[model samples]
Target: MVYQTDLDAVLDFPILIGDIGGTNARFAIVVDSYAEPREFPVLFTADFPTIDDAIQSVLDQTSLLPRSTVLAVAGPVDGDEIDLTNSDWVVRPKQMMKTFGFGDVIVLNDFEAQALAVVALGEAHLEKIGGGSAETVGSRVVLGPGTGLGVAGLVHAQHTWIPLPGEGGHIDLGPRTERDYEIFPHLERIEGRISAEQVLCGRGLVNLYRAIAAADGKEAPFSDPAEITSAGLERSNPLATETLDLFVTYLGRVAGDLGLIFMSQGGVFLTGGIVQKIVPALRNGVFRAAFEDKAPHRTLMAEIPVYVITHPMAAVCGLGAYARTPGRFGVETAGRRWRAR
Candidate 1:
């Protein structure tokens, strides 16, 4: 879908778009709307003590400073203080502006930015997971499991797009099967209270593996999600395979529930690093089955299209779009728009 926005408007100043997640921080510069975004080297979030450190590192290496910036963070955004849910990085927009002397700084929930990117995405950016055609006019939801589970929604109203961001990942995990029941108790005990994030993130992969192992009276020795995923995809380890299967199934169930809640007939997009790595597992029918398992609303669920965003610059595109036509995005910053310093 080609976004109907003017890219030239955003190029008046050197604009920096940062997609900061628990695992990685991706930076890009907006040269023109018709041109490809120039990206910086990927920075691991854990290596830096704070967001300021990471930004400074990028500045030091690139020898260029942005006149304005939009940072997409993996957490809730409220006021001037922002903290990442899965990483120990706190970002303060006011403090950052004082330190860097930028003209404007905008902070957004990572998935909120994802919601905006959904509109800017083209067919080449999306891969259909399941469902029939999208409703063309309604709500569209985007959720994904990565360093943590992120959820957001987008709706078109009065020829403008609005993004709804919330901590939907922290919702309670609902069990739907005998295996689910067996594992629920373990996850609850392990988390002190079982939230969806406890079992749907990178850490959640290991958590599921351990929970399944505990349920079957076996010991799970895996320490990393990558190790578990490798073992599962290869099918060399039965426990690992079961763990991945359970993860995909639960993901589908949660996605279905979200679709029904939002009535996301427009579409549901899965955006995250983890899903991109496990695309094969998502296509093996387990995910689709669980997604359509809504009893009375099976037909409604089938009508809601779902796709995975494969674009590396999804969130950046959203930030750039908002920069071009902030009013169309319905984002209120009290008239504080991006300007060259």
Candidate 2:
């Protein structure tokens, strides 16, 4: 959808947009509203051992100095208590402002940035996975599974875009078939009360592997989700392939269900570390079928376009998108504690 933001105002020097994830913090240098953002530099949080150190490393790489910055983080963003969902680098926003000497340092949920990006991204930016011809305006759901399942919705409110944050990834998850019931029991040890996140996200790959293994009357054997995916790509491990396929199928099912719930006529965009790793696997075949396999109401859901966000730096674009939206985020970095609506 077209976002006619007078973003022409975000001058190059003061604006900085960063997407902070569990593993690496992606940073981009912005010159102005219309000028293209520079190549993203990924800084491993582990390399610096602290977010501030990582921030400094990025600044050291870039020549332009930014006065205002928006940090998109992968965790629940509440006031100044921004604890990263997967990592230990907790950001104290007020402290950050004092330390960085920024006039405005706005932090928001990472998925929220992904949602806001929908307004700025066009057809060339998106990779179609399922659904039909898209329109310029409509309600959309932008979510994905990675270190953890993240959810966000883009509601086109008249002339502006309203990015809605949701704890949807934590919503109760249930079994659709008898096989699933058996699978849930095996996961009981780790996930007493299963949420969609349990079978999605990075750790989710392991859950899927275990569930499938348990269903096969065997123990799921993988140290981590990454291992399982690597085995699946190698095609030498039968169990890994089956596990990954089931993960994709279930991912489609859950995303499809979300589309129906939100009536996300605008589109259902799947973006995250999981999809990026399995892009080739998802591009053709069963994944799209499962995404479009909604029963009874299939016709209505089928038309909802689904895209796999190919751009790794789309989140940064999302930050740019949000900055363009007026009254979207109010900033007050008076002190390590931040207060916002």
Candidate 3:
């Protein structure tokens, strides 16, 4: 499938860049091509009845008018109306252009923004995991486990970066080890099938804990992922500890799979709140061991680098990069871009 599109579009100066997710919406204003984005405080989606209200709040606070906007939303960017995968807020680029009097409005998937950040972010913003040096010219993968699991690929062709976003998180995942077999049967299923998100997201941690507990015939006392993580990190609960180990192992496996699929010699980056929190767990040998267990391709996988994105505003930074120089990235804006009449 053709994943890249060539469209002649330029966002005017004083652009508004937003990274809208299920729980939080972050906004920033770029005064000019050379100016850095001035970010506003994050807003909870629950507090705002609609996306319009949220944008208005940011405008009121900033008191800076923007002629164009670039939004990174949590769901697919298809057609005029876009609905968030995990929230009630619906984003309509055409409506936004009309409401805000914008000359241009460009929308992209949240993970696509993450993939762009992989290119825009410097080494200081990334914490290295187990792997060799990243090749200068190869595809890259960025996946995050947060409110949900997001996956995207970044490719370099024609001297421009291309971000490929898809529902890779929903891909089927199965057990490969004896321990996995024992826990797989107990985990909850979506439509009677297990996907990567089933055990890789925030709620996925809780699911893993519960499944592990069920396998051991023990009562699970924790329902919140944070609680389980805290207990696991502190070594206060065995079940939580086991859950965390398995979670990291599975994450490594999935990252390795994507790395092989894209030949991501540039790197495989891990993003989101969960990854940042579990840096200690990821550094343990189990994660890397699982990642390199692909048998025949173990040597090749070992040579690819892995990193955790440490930037607090990765998506915002990505949008800022695109707004500053749209030609630097090959973004498909056929149905995702709106213009003033």
Candidate 4:
């Protein structure tokens, strides 16, 4: 059952919306334009050999047969095969269409779906940190620190929102303080240099903890990020506590830089499991102070609102929105969209 349509055509319902990350794959089905997205239980990538197997498991449990799908992946969406950055599974949209008997498939970067969620989400779904009210009109940015760092920008134009996704997490990070200079040399480098992702992600938290321990000439014990986070938040270990402080500080600096670059007056959103877990630390003056530390544009930075996305299915909701009303968003589908011809 092949469906033919132009580049700007609205996707036919029912639609499968997915947010595929390194650790988990979340799926939802929207039966129609007016119907809410019915979410399925989260699936671990390791539990399934391929994405097809995961989807098949979900299909076995439900009666819904979606005609189209929009998948937000953790890696770059280019060519026919899309590989997840931190996972072993590879997504092939063309192959999916044949296997699932779908008409269309749209691929998006994970952060791009996050950017779309920023526009679709309401106040109830956001937790404010510090800063003035968001501007009624302007660009917005969303950053997530999870298995890896993800970044995207959203801009309103021609009465529609356009999401811009890029590899902003790989940007270089340099030390600015005496404390930073002491610990940075001990940080693990990707290719001889430490990027923002080196100290901002899940493994990055462990890296920060080890670096702090190494700088103090102590043996690091914890290997898991959760252990470090628990010790830091509880103040059970001095090294873990200091590591969390530096982690938030560096996150603030990076967020401030992105805020200035995009002039995100709409707001700057912080997503992923890591941000939500450290909300208490994020509001404890250190994060906000570092965000406002931009000398030349301190005033401008202060006016930009920052929020943490509280909704668990934000990316799936974003894809559902696009599936329901494709004309409302200016998503470029030239190469990313595949059809069963």
- TM per candidate: 0.90, 0.87, 0.97, 0.97
lDDT of 1 at 89: 92
What does candidate 1's lDDT look like per residue over 1-341, in tens digits? 22324332233446678889989998876654444556788899989998999888877866567777878899877655677887899988778878887777777788888998988888999999888888766889999888889999898877778788889998988777888889776663433678888899998888888888888889998989998988888888999999989999999989998998889999989988788878889999999999999999998887788899998778877877765555577554432233435
Q: On residues 178-294, what C-alpha lDDT tens digit does candidate 4 reach at each position? A: 999999999999879999999999999999999999999998999999888888888899988998899999999999999999999988999988998899999999999999899
Candidate RMSDs in order: 3.7, 4.2, 1.5, 2.7
User: Poorest 10 consecutive residues of model 1 by lDDT?
Assistant: 1-10
Clashing pairs in 4: none
Off by over 4 Å in 1: 1-12, 32-35, 188-191, 334-341
Comparing 2 and 4 on lDDT, the stronger one: 4
Span of 10 residues, lowest total lDDT, candidate 2:
332-341
Query: In model 1, how large is the Cα lDDT of residue 61?
Result: 69
Model 2 lDDT tens row, 1-341:
22223442232344677888887788876666555556456877777677888888777877777777778888877766678888889887677677777766667788888887777777787888767876666888988898788898877664666777767888777777676776777663344688888888887778778777877787666868888988887776898987777787778888888888888888899897778888767865667777777888878877888888878788888777555443343222223223221
